[model samples]
Target: MKTMTRPRYRLAIAAVAAATALTACGGGSTGADGGLPSNVSFGGGASGAIYGVLATGMAEIVNTNLQGVNARAEATAGGLQNTRLVRDGELTFGLTDPRVVYPAVRASGEFADEPPAEDLRFVMNGYPSLYQVTALDPNIRSIGDLRGKRVCTAAGIQTAMLGELLTPYGLAVGDLSLSNLEWTECADRMKAGDIDVIGYAGGPGAAVLIQAFAGSPTAHIVGIDPDKATAMSAQFPWWKPSTLPAGTYDGQTAEVPTVEISGGTLVTRADTSEELVHQFLTALESHFDQFSKVHPLASYYSLPGTATNTMSDVLPTHPGAARFYRDKGIPGY
Candidate 1:
């Protein structure tokens, strides 16, 4: 296994510049209800990504459920960016992963120096995001097998999570030829044989994986070893061992065990009125079927215990959300 080198100074400088540009353009104004308009804006992932679609569907659901609120979903870089936007009040809401929320809240670890953006709160859990490790080589069977091979972990949060996911298996970025590419780019690289494996953490029924396997029948999801998966979960509380059942996609027949995490969170500012948060959840529960119609992933949003169970531990539930749960016999700390 080879280690990944630190990104060049030029790349770091460019990233800073890009972040500044985004910060400047992303912030929006608050609406009359102290909520952004029903046309409230949501920050989503890259174009054509599942999170992007999920955001659009959520916006539609919110807009349809509330009389004055109209939600609009916009493409974003991903979780870290969305967190920053939501904290800054640039977006009324956004979809984010539970793992990313932890470091940001602790104001240590990866997000050190940028203290936890305390204002964030959860609306609901979207889906389960399983870490899928796929390789073009049939001989590679586990995370450890790709020691010297080229591995593409999609950019931003996905890349960060992949690094964390491999730690317990004794694999690090240094062990493989690491390529930080976008999911679409990673899929394309895998199809071109430029990368030996692509590690992705995404909502169930990911289109990217489906397309990649369809393009190259040789490409397949390499199952994580159960013992390794269990150990990884113990090391990272946010991650739990999970499986993707067969029939999710063509040629994928057996349930593959892997480390899983909450796919998305509906977050809002802490200062937002409790009444508004309650109203939002009320609307969501009442029109779940309408929301599910917005995106297939929304089906998970309908689970009975979805809201209370999947919230990121790092984020304190909004007072509004806490109240709603308390009424239903789910205690809030």
Candidate 2:
């Protein structure tokens, strides 16, 4: 929403083994081990999206590091969508963006008409990326050029942000031939010459965007005009300035200006036991090596900025996660 903080987190990882041991004290399904419950479903982003990949990687990390636990990442819509799933109990935990969390908690912005999911709780926020608007056509450059193009965006925050992305340039969501298809579908359509542009945000090496780069040498990132960036910050102040630096993705030699999006926040319903969440965090830290192995972009998950300042904060932090944070002396509880 409008008041959400620019998602920032700094995981306090000064001592890993001790932190892991302390957090892993009991919990999980095992009577003998501090492992998570079996077959837990983790809400990743929509299939083939960055969140999906990250969730899948996390599942593996949970599996490899925690015994008696069978955590699995399930493909779901995305941050905002996952928020609902977690609240409804269909998902045990989910990765979400602060932008979605703020609005959904208070039932404002796009959620102003929707009911609030009051049970959601924060785990941690880390890993961030910027709005990377891509187009294979050389004619597409500024956000205004997207006016008549078939731009792919899914439901939830994607559409909301797209609307905001267009406003500074005097374009609205209606100005574009918008496609609300899933991430993979959008990528497929782009390759089939059915779509003109797609905008997404994630760390430097998201798998889906990388595939787009490999599929077409013509793929190039579009940069927002300096004036537009300033204008966007003025209205949707939650968005902080960001840049997809040169060489972060293939076939690009110049930095493209953009706005930052929230990194992943592992969350669950308030009813989830404190012990379970605590063990989950413990496993997460203990398996950092294996987790990072899932993707180059996973490197962004290291403990860092983890709170919502851009968005309004009415949701309470999970007691388990909060306990761990306090124990570690991590900043920005």
Best by TM-score: 1
Candidate 2 lDDT over 224-291, as tens digits, reads: 87778888877876567778889978878988888876677777777676677777677777778877
CA lDDT scores, all candidates in order: 0.72, 0.71
Q: Which runs of model 1 end up more than 4 angstroms from their true locations?
A: 1-39, 215-218, 311-313, 326-333
Give the Cα error of residue 98 in candidate 1, in Å. 1.5
RMSD values for the candidates in order, in angstroms, are: 4.2, 9.9
Task: Name the runs in model 2 displaced over 4 angstroms.
Answer: 1-40, 45-49, 60-72, 109-114, 136-140, 150-157, 179-196, 205-219, 306-312
